[model samples]
Target: ALYYDNGTFFTKDLPKFQPYEQQANFEYEERFKRTEGKAPSGSARKCHFCLHRLNAGMLPACVTTCPCGAMYFGDKNNPKGLAMQLLAFNRGIRLKVSQGTEPRVYYLTSEVGTADNLKACLACHGA
Candidate 1:
């Protein structure tokens, strides 16, 4: 799932990277043996609340990075629900979607917008 980004430059050669994937799997096992029982990815701790999804509210990075007040984040169950409102605004349009193992990140963009360029750029530029 991590290796399958549409915008990643290496997306075209992913099959050729299979051996490295196997090597990573082996390295993980070796690291586990060395550490007894610890995450091979390393020891980084996040806030407890940050670990859980809080509905369609502001995701972590968006909340932190928005310099302007353009981005809004909150629960979707409000009388003015953000998620429902946004979807309703696009009722007739198609929404491209993908299922990840457990996706905690969401991007809101349209085909005609800067988002489209971003996706294409990622595919060829290793974003």
Candidate 2:
């Protein structure tokens, strides 16, 4: 059913944002230049869902590096697809629903106590 549903056009620049903090982000840029001997492209860059990486038959950076197995990806049609099953089971919700931009990315609702490594710091601190 989902496979037959036509999806919107996907592109690298659909989502855009202004440059973030100079100190925080620029630190990464500086490190990249020091380690890799090349300057980063610009002051800021947005996530493109790792289009080039996907094209190269590799997983996205976030999904690959996410700790605690939080990220999921794969073909939705496959019965064994983790991403599809998680979404189909209603454990995940789409972001920016009102914008009509249906993204494949999903944030799982079933997972609990992820913040601060499941520690109730706020509750204990009486905040």
Candidate 3:
């Protein structure tokens, strides 16, 4: 996510960028070496959680656009909302537990690529 901080731009993208890009390139090279090693087709665009839409009570475009029905969005305050329910029922994990930024987006622990232990999606007690 990008944020304004007194003439500076900050985002989690910087840490994630190089590793992911290099990994993608490595996979592509291994796949296409016999055919002249063309880079894999992928979008490197970064996305901030859509604050505008969230403020307007609508889900982010990516959530709605997910073709596999993998994304869920709802008011965290509503204990009955699907998102809240998921958070309650499933063990959600932060993308990076070590940083302790207390991320809002979390993955179900059952999900193969989730973190080990992290606080609530909203940093329940406090930041």
Candidate 4:
């Protein structure tokens, strides 16, 4: 489930969309060892929520580097956490709810006017 949500499957051959050379750089090697260890080619790769930083009592880079202060990360089970408070206050919604994936990420959206407006937006986005 975690892989499906945030993983990227890399191939030796270039991909069709936004193709780029899959070369071994310093960061690539470091991240590979840090996350998916000893995986074969074409395996899924994803950051494991920066486990090294978490173990060192630091927040993930995404949450720390968010310039707008829109991202929050913490224990979801903690009632006093800012993430939970924002979720409750904004009535956050998870994507693909019918799929039963139970995604860990939550999104907050602003009012898009009437139901007709929402339908139009979804239709345009092919949601």
Candidate 5:
């Protein structure tokens, strides 16, 4: 859920039982200045699940280059896929389940320290 307010871009965070948190404030103008006043297409600066790569039968860049091997991608309905196996084994949860959007993304819960560590790494690595 990326949005533009004034010249800033941000995304809303979804928690299991808490209110949505607005996270990741980024300057729209500074980030997209090269476009020279043209509006960007698609979901602004958000991920579109790498449709181009997926159509080409390749993994998304994020999944392929994840330093910690934390990301996985596969057909959700495929019983033998690693993503499905992990989701079932770990009891993965999806965001905004009540919305009935049936989002394909699933998250596996982790310790607080593990999440903090990942955040630090992403901050430094520009993920």
Candidate 6:
């Protein structure tokens, strides 16, 4: 199951393009940022969006914990070419494409008007 999968909360560098203003809430946190100790504090991963954020060539915590191998992450650019392939596979269906904050994490299928999948993922991830 997908966890911490919110388009807004769990991805790396959001695209910085026009009409896609980044929401303040989706801003990344630093690894060393102080948390307020709330059950759902937003500061835990602020570092995820820092200018220095980059793929370490390993899975993130949730990805590593996934038993079903449903999640995949990699460069949309470069020799990886995985993202290009995915886009080709889903040419017509819509994703969360307008967030201006282009999240590197993408959901493979369409969840166009349904919050169920997104909610389920968040609950699974404890977000």
Scored by lDDT, the top model is: 5
**lDDT against the true structure, each candidate:** 0.41, 0.53, 0.53, 0.58, 0.61, 0.45
Pitting candidate 1 against candidate 2, the one with the higher TM-score is 2
lDDT string for model 1 (1-127, tens) is 1232222323335555334332332231233221213333444423323322333343745455545433445454664777556544543232343443343223445545556556555665566
> Given candidate 4, what's the lDDT at residue 123?
57
lDDT of 3: 0.53
Specify the poorest-scoring 10-residue window by lDDT in model 5: 29-38
> Which model scores highest in TM-score?
5
Candidate 5 per-residue lDDT, tens place, 6-125, comes to: 322232232331222223222332222212122334235656677767777899889988776778999977999998887776757888889998778887765546677578668747
Compared with the true structure, model 3 gives a TM-score of 0.46
The lowest-lDDT stretch of 10 consecutive residues in candidate 4 is 32-41
lDDT of 2 by residue, 1-127 (tens): 0111232122324463223311222332233221122224443455666776777899878788755455678876796787777777656677898898877667666555557533443444345
lDDT tens readout by residue for model 4, 1-127: 0133334434324444232223332333253321322342235555567677787799988878755455689788898988788677775788888899778888765564446545655654557
Which residue pairs overlap in candidate 4's backbone?
none
| Residue 36 of model 3, lDDT score | 17
- Give the TM-score (vs. native) of candidate 5: 0.57
Residues 38-113, candidate 3, lDDT per residue (tens digit)? 2233323234566666666788887887654566877778999888888897787778767887677777655543
TM per prediction: 0.29, 0.49, 0.46, 0.52, 0.57, 0.39
Model 6 CA lDDT for position 71? 54
What's the ranking of the predictions by lDDT, best on top? 5, 4, 2, 3, 6, 1
Q: List candidate 2 segments past 4 Å from native.
A: 1-44, 111-127
CA error at residue 84 for candidate 5, angstroms: 0.8
Error of 2 at 62 (Å): 1.1
Collision count for each candidate, in order: 3, 0, 0, 0, 0, 7
* Local error of candidate 4 at residue 24 (angstroms): 9.5
lDDT for model 2: 0.53
Stretches of candidate 3 off by over 4 Å are: 1-46, 111-127
